[model samples]
Target: MTAPAAPEVLRHVDALAEVVGRQHVLVGEQVPARHVQDLWGSDRKGVASVVVCPGTPAEVARVLRLCAEHRQPVVVQGGMTGLVSGGVPGPEEVVLSTERLDSIGEIDPAIATVTAGAGVTLADLQDEAARHGLVVPIDLASKGSATIGGCVATNAGGVNVVGYGMTRQHVRSLQVALADGRLLELSTPLVKDNAGFDLKQLFIGSEGTLGVVTAATLALRQAPRTRTGVFCAVADVAGALELLTAIRAQLPGMLTAFEVVWADAYAVLDGLDLRLPLPMGYPVYVLAEVQGGRPEADSEALLACLASIEHVLLDSAVADTAAELAVFWQARERIPSEILRMQPLFGFDVSVSARDLQDCLERMRAELTERWPQVKLLVFGHLGDDNVHIAVVTGEQTRKRKAEVEHIVYGCVSRSSGSISAEHGIGFEKRPYLGYTRSPEEMELMRSLKALLDPAGILNRGRVLTWGNETDPA
Candidate 1:
C-alpha cells in the first residue's frame, strides 16, 4: 500500500488528535522507537506516522471511525512484548496503542471471573486475582510486559497450559471494535452461552487483523493452596513421555507442568554464574509440577508418584519451598537471555504428537547439523502439551542464513504433521511457511473471513495472511 502524502498524513493525524485528545496523540518524532518494531525485530520495520493512545473503548472506536473515513491503515498495538512482530506498524500507518486503556474491572468471586481492559498487564491481573484468592490460568515468562489483549489476540499458551489451557479457554467474553468502527460485544460471563455462533472466537488469535480487542472477561479458578515441583533427569524423549504418563495416571489433575530440556543444550546453564540444583547433567531433564489444596498431603503424593517412576528417571530433585523451586527453574528461564548473548539466533515454537516429538527433533537436528555444523541448538518446552521450543545459535552467521535454517527446521515439522507455530501467531515472519502447516482450503477460508470482516482491510494490513501478496489503499 502506498503511503499517504506528508500533507495527507498530517491531516489524518490532526483528525485523530481531535478524536482522542491531542495530548494522547503523538506524531512523527514524538512516537517512541518501541512503537515501530516489536520485541522480535520485523523485516517490514517502519516508523508509524502517528501513535494514538485511546483511554476508552469509545475513544478507540472514534479513532477507528476517523481513520476509516480517511482511508488510513491502522496497526493496533498492545504491550509491545510480542516476539512475532504482530503489533509492529508500517511507515505510513497510524498506531493505536492500548497502553492508556489500562484498567482492571471488578472480579466476581461468585462466578469465578474477572473483567479487565485490553491494556491491563498480565502481572497486574495475576496480582489482583491473588488478593481475591483466585488465579488467571494463562501465564508466560513475559507476563509483566505482555497485555491481556495481546495474550488473547495470540491465544497465548505457556507452561501452565498443560494443566489449564490457552488464553482462549479462559476468555469468557470479549468486547471488540470492527474495522469499520462498529462494536461487537460477544459471548458473556455466563458459562453456558450457546445462543448461536461464538463470534468472539473469530477475533481471538486473529492477531487484530479482524478487529481491535478492547476488553475481555476471563474465567478464573480458586488459587492452588499447595504447589509441589520436581525436576527429574530422563534418558530421552521416550522416557520423558513415559514419566509424563505415569504422573498423569497417578496424580490425574494434579500435574501442572511437564517441561523437557535436552541435556547438551541445557548444559550451558552450568556455565552461568547462577545456582544449579543438580550436580550432574543427564541426557534429558523434565521438570514436573503438581498443585492441590493440602500442602503436606500433596507434597507426599507427588514424591510417592515420582518414586514410582524411578525406572524412567536417572536423577531427581524435589522442591517444596519457593527458594528451592526458583533454583530449579532458574536454569530454564535464564536460557533466552543467555542465548541472546550469543547473537544471530533463530527461535521456534512448534508442536507434534507426544510420540512424534522425538523423531521430529532428531530429523531437524540432523538436517541443521549437516548444513551448519557450527550451529548450536538448544531445545526445551512444555512437553506434556506436545509443545517444544527450539533455539538455534549461529555463532558466526549471516543475515541470509536465517532463512536457510528456518527452511530446514520447518520442513521437518511439516513432514511430521507438526504445527509450525504452537502458541505464537503467524505474524509476518511465519507468513510464508503458513502454507507448510495449513491446507489450501483452510488458507482460503481464512482469507475469506478476513475479506468479510475487513472488506477495506484497514486493520493490521500485511500481517498474518497478506491478501494476494498485493498492496492496495484501504
Candidate 2:
C-alpha cells in the first residue's frame, strides 16, 4: 500500500490532468508496475509522483511546461520495453506515458515514408507498412511492445541492421517536446534536406535526455518478393566471420541478416526441449538471410555462396519455407529466455570491430571462466553490425558481484575500443560505464548539450548524464 501524495504534488497532478484529462492521470497505487520496472528485471523499482498520459503533442507540451514551472523532474516512457532503465522514473518523479499517442498516419508511397505517433509499436508500424507493399527496416525482438518513440530514442539496431540500418537511418524527421514545453519540429520529409543542421539526429540516440520524442516520419523500403535464410554451424567466431566475408563478397546486397550464436547458447534449446536445427557440438552457429525478387534465384545464390565456404562450416540447415525460417529464428531468439531461467544473470549488449570481436570474447571468456569456474556464459548477436549480446550466470550472488562482472566485460570492450552499449543507450544501468567508451571531452560535450536544451535537468533526470553527487538508487 502507498501513502497519499503531498498537497503540492496533488496540485501539480491536477494541473497536468487539466491538459490531458483526470482519467488519464494515475497516482500512487493507480500507477502500474510496468511503468516503474525495466525489462532487465532489476529489483530496484521507481516511485512515480504521478503518471500522466497525453494524447497529442500539444498536450505533451503543456504537461512539460507545467512540470518545468514547478521544477518537477519528468521521466518520459514509451512502451517501457527498454532493457536499460532509461524509461524508469525516479522517486517522486512525474512519469509522462506516451501510450495514448497511438495514432498512425497514412503511408506515403510516393516518398516511402510513414508518420506515426510515439506510442505506436514497431510491429504495428511494420504491419501497416506491409499493407502498402513497403517495410520498416528496423526490426527487434521487442517489436510487438517497443514503440517507435523508444526505438528512435535508443536508435535501436536489430537483426536487419546488416541489410537496412539502425533506427537512426530510418528516421527522417522527429517531433520532440522539449523540457521547457516547446514543441520542436526537427525536420521535413524531404529525402535530402541539407539546408541546415539535421537536428533530429541529436534526439535519435539521445535516450530521451534532451527532449521527448512525440512522433516521427520513418523512411521505408519496398518489400522483398522473396526471402531465404540458412542456419549454419561454424567452427568458431573467426570461421563465422570468414563465412560472413564470403557471403558478402558473393551475394552482395542481397544479404539481410548475419547472426551468430555460440554453442553454449544454442544448447539452451535442449534444456527447453525445443527442436534443434543441428547438433549442439559445434562451437558457433550462424543464421544468414537474403532477400531478392526471385525466390529460386535467391535460394540458389545463398546455397551456392555457402557451398563455396563449406570448409569453414561444420554443418548447415536451409530455411526455404516461411515455417522453416521461423523455426530457425525461434531457436536463436529463445536463447535469452532459456539462459535467463537461472537464478541470477547479467546481460550485456556491446559492439566491437569485426577484427577484434573474436579476441575480445576469448579474453572475456577466459577471465570469467578462471574467476568463476561454474559460470555460464551465453553469447550471440548481429555479426554483420559488430554487436554482441552476452548473458552471464556465475552461480553466485549477482547483485553483489555485478560490478566485478561488468569490470571484466567492459574492460575488454574498452581496451578493444568498442562501445559498452552497442544499441541500448546509457541508462541508469550503464551510467557508471559511460567513460569506458567515451572520453572526458566527448562526455563533456554531451553534458553541454544537455544543459543547453534541458537547463533545468527536468527531463529524464539522472539518465545518460548523471546529476551532481547523485548515485544509483538502492
Candidate 3:
C-alpha cells in the first residue's frame, strides 16, 4: 500500500490544529462527502481528500501557505449553495470550507457600512443590518443558505438589481487571502478610489480562481421607513417594460424593485397555487415594489402609477403591512424554489437591453415552445435590469437532456447578445458557453489575468476558463 505523501500539508494542518484545535479539521474519510460540492448536487470530478474549516483570516492564510509550499490545489467553499460546480472538491485537493469563518464583525450605522466575515449567511447579515436600521440591497432568494462570500464571489443579482444593483456594486472593499498566503487587507469602505487598479474586483465573480474571499466591507442603504409592493398583471414583457418606465417616470420615489414574470412561469405559479390574489389571465406579471421614507406617500404613488399603465389593464394587489409584503414577495421567491424541485431544471440567467428584452424573450420562448413543446419552461426574474432566469424543466435528470436544454438556451443567448450567466458565476457549468458572452480578445484578457494571478493553475481548476492545466495535486 502506498502511504500518503502529505508531509508538508500535515505539518501545517498540525500547526493550524494547535491554534484552532483538531476538531475543525476533517482529514481522510472524516471529511463529509456532502461538503465537497455546491447546490448543483453531484459528484465532482475532483473531490478533496481532506476538508479544513478555518475560523479566521490567520487560519485561512496559514492553510494557503501550506498548500503553496507543497504546491497543492485548494478549493474554497461557502454554504455549498452555489449552482455552479466550482465548489466541488477534487480527489487530491483540499477543501477550505468557510463554515468556521462565520462572523458579523460590525455594523456601522453612522456610515452605513457592514464589515462581515465571508462565511456569514445572507440572512444573518440582513438581520444584523436591520438591527442597525440599514439594508444591504443585494437580496437573493438563497439568503437563508447563501453566504456573503458566495454572493460576492458571483457578484449576485436578485430582484433588487433593478433598483440597488449587484453584489459587486454594493461591495465597497474585499478582504481576500491569495493562493500564496498573502493576506490582501482591502476592506477599505471608501466610496471612490481611483488611485490605481481596483483590486477588489480581482476576486469578485472569479469563482475562487485567483483567491479566497475572507471578509468584505459592504455598502449599505438606509433602511426604508416604508415600502409599498404591487403584484400586478401586465399584457406582456413589453407592457411590463412600459409599466416600469411610466411608474419610474411618474412615481420614482416608490420604484425600488420592478420584477416581471413570463406567463409561462406565472402559469406554473398558478398550477402550484402560489398565485397572487389578483386574477392571473395576463401574458405577464410584474411584481413592482416601491420604497420611500414616508409610507403614506409611497403607497399613494404606487396606486397612482398603477392607474397610468393604460396599455395593460393592470389589476394590482397592494401589500399593506410587513406580513402582507412578505406574502407578496413569496409569490416571486417560491417560483425558483418550487421549480428547482422538478428534476434538475436548466436555469439560464441572462441579461439584455430592456427594449430588446421583449424581443429576446419572445424569440427564446417561441423557439423553445416550438421545438420542445412538451418541455416545461419557467421564466421569471428582475425585469428592472433586463435579467431573466429561464428554467427549462426536463422530467428526465440525465446529463444528455440537461446538455440539450443548455445548448438550445445558450444558442439563443449568443444570438440575442445576452449574457450567458448573469448572477451565477461562469463556474464549470457555464464554462463552455462563456464564448457566447465573451469575445476571443476579451477571453484572452481573462486568461491572461488568470495565468498571472494563479501561474501554478492551483485556484479552483476547471472553472471560469475552458482550458487550463490542472494544478499540483494535494
Candidate 4:
C-alpha cells in the first residue's frame, strides 16, 4: 500500500524517456491500467515507472540496456491474452509493450516459411498466409488478440492439436534479444541442423524469463483443400477417448481436432448470454474435425471415419454448411466465455496422459460432487492433446467454496503427475501446485536456470520459477 520513493522512480523514468523519446516513454496518470496484468484474475496490476514501446529490435535492445543501467525490473506484454499472471507488472517496474513493432518479413514459397515480428497478432499472420494460399495450423482461441511472440513464448495449443502440434513444433527459428543488449539472430530455414546445440529451443517456452523474443521465422503448412466438422454425442469420457482413437486409426492424417464437452457445462451457458447450436441432452459431446489435401477425397474419408466409430450413440442432423460449423465451434467457445461471464470460477488448464484422462476426470468429478452437491462442474478440452479445461463454478461472493474446490482439484491433478498448466504458461495461479507435476530435482534445476538467466530475478519476476525462494520443494 506504500508508493515508491518519488525521486529515484522519477529519475529512472527520465532516463528511459531519454533513450526511447518522451512520446514512447509513458508515465503519470496517462498510463492505462490495461498494461498491468494478463487474462487471469489477479491484483498484480501496478503503474509502471515508465512504459517503453520500441519500434525495432535494435530500439528494444537499447531500451533494455538503459533499463539495465537503471537496474529497474521490467515486464514484457504482448496482446495480454495469457491465462497466467506472468505478464503482470509491479510497482516501480517498467513495461515493454510490443505494440508498435509490427512488421512482416519474407515469405518463402518453396519452404513455406514466413518471418514476422513478435508484435504481429495471430489474425494478421493468418490473413497474410491466406493471401499466399497457405495456413498456419497452430490456432488458439486468443488468436484474435494474442501476439506471435506470446504464442511462441507460451507454445500455445489450440483446437487443431489433433493434427498440427503446438506452436513450438511449428516454429523453425527464433530471433531473441537478451536482457543485457545482446541480439541473437537465429533465423534458420534449414530443416536439418545439427549444430553444436539447439539454442533456440531454450527460449521457446521460458515465458520470457531467459530473453525477450523479438521476431521469429515460422513454418507454414499448405492450406487444406477440404475440411469437415462433426458434432457427435458420447456417453462418457472413456467413450469419447475410444471414439477418438478409433477415428484416428481410421482417418490417420485426416483427423484434425477431437474436443469433448460435459453435458453439465451446458448448464453454465443456460440463462447466460452464451448460445449453442447443438441440442443439450447428451451426457457428453464431441466436436471433431478432419482436413485433407484433397477436397472430395478427404470428405469421403472423413465420412468413413465418422461411420466407423462405434461409440457414437446418435449422429443425425449433420450440417454441412458453414453456418453449421460456426454453430459447433460456438458451443465449445461458449463454455469458457460463459465461465468468465457467470462468476468467479476456480479453473484449471491441466493435462494428464491420454490413457489417464478418463481416470483423472472421473476421480475429480466425483470428489467435487460430494463436496458441493449443488455445484455445477463443467469440463471441456482439446482431447487430441490430452489437455483439459475444468471449471468448478463458485459464486464470487463466497471465497470458501472456491478455496475448498481448488485444494481438492489440484491435489488430484498433482497425484496424476499431470502438468498444472498445458498451453497456458504457468503464471501465479498454479505456482503453489507446481510440485504436483514436477519432481523436486526438476524444480531445483528450473530455479538454477532462473538464477543463471535472470541473476537479479527481475524478468517475469514471480512466474514459472517460483520455487526458488517463494516455494518449498517437497
Give the number of the best model, judged by lDDT: 2
Instruction: List the candidate 1 regions with Cα displacement exceeding 4 Å.
Output: 1-8, 42-44, 468-474
The worst-scoring run of ten residues by lDDT in candidate 3 lies at: 1-10
Q: TM-score ranking from best to worst?
A: 2, 1, 4, 3
Model 3 agreement with the true structure over 1-474: per-residue lDDT tens digits: 112425444555665576567898777667665675676564344445667888889888888887877777777888877777878775666778887778887777788888889899999999999898988898877788889998888888887887888899888888998888899976468887777788988789888888899998899999888877878886776778778888889876557788778777766566665546566677778788888887587778777777777557567678888888887887877777667667666777788767777666667667777656767777888878878888886555564666666777887777778888888887777787787788989988988988887777777877888544433110
- Each prediction's number of clashing residue pairs: 0, 0, 6, 0
Q: Which ten residues in a row have the lowest lDDT in candidate 2?
A: 1-10
True-structure lDDT of candidate 2: 0.88
TM-score of every prediction relative to native: 0.96, 0.97, 0.91, 0.93
> For model 4, which pairs clash?
none
As for lDDT, the candidate ahead, 2 or 3, is 2
Candidate achieving higher lDDT, 2 or 4: 2
For residues 1-474, could you state the per-residue lDDT of candidate 2 as single tens digits?
544555556668768878999999999889877887886576557766688999899999999999999888889998777777888776668889999899999887878999999999999999999999999999988888899999999999999999999998888899999999999999888888997889999899999999999999999999999988999997887898888898889988988899999888888788566677887788989999889898678888888888898889899999979889888888888877777787688899999998998899889989999989988888999989999998888878757888889999999999999999999888888988898999989989999999999898988888888886785431
lDDT for each residue of candidate 1 in 1-474, tens digit (9 for 90 to 100): 233325555677667878888998887767777787776554556667778999999999888888887778888998877767788776767889999778998887877899899999999999999988999999888889889899999999998989998999999999999888888799988999999999999999999999999999999999998887988888899999888888889888988888888876677777668887665568888888888898788888888888887888888889979788878778778866666666677888888888898888888888888877787788889998989888887666555677888888888889999998999888777877888899989988998999998887889888888765563221
User: lDDT per prediction?
Assistant: 0.84, 0.88, 0.77, 0.76
User: Candidates sorted by lDDT, descending order?
Assistant: 2, 1, 3, 4
Global Cα lDDT for candidate 3: 0.77
lDDT of 1 at 114: 90
Best by TM-score: 2
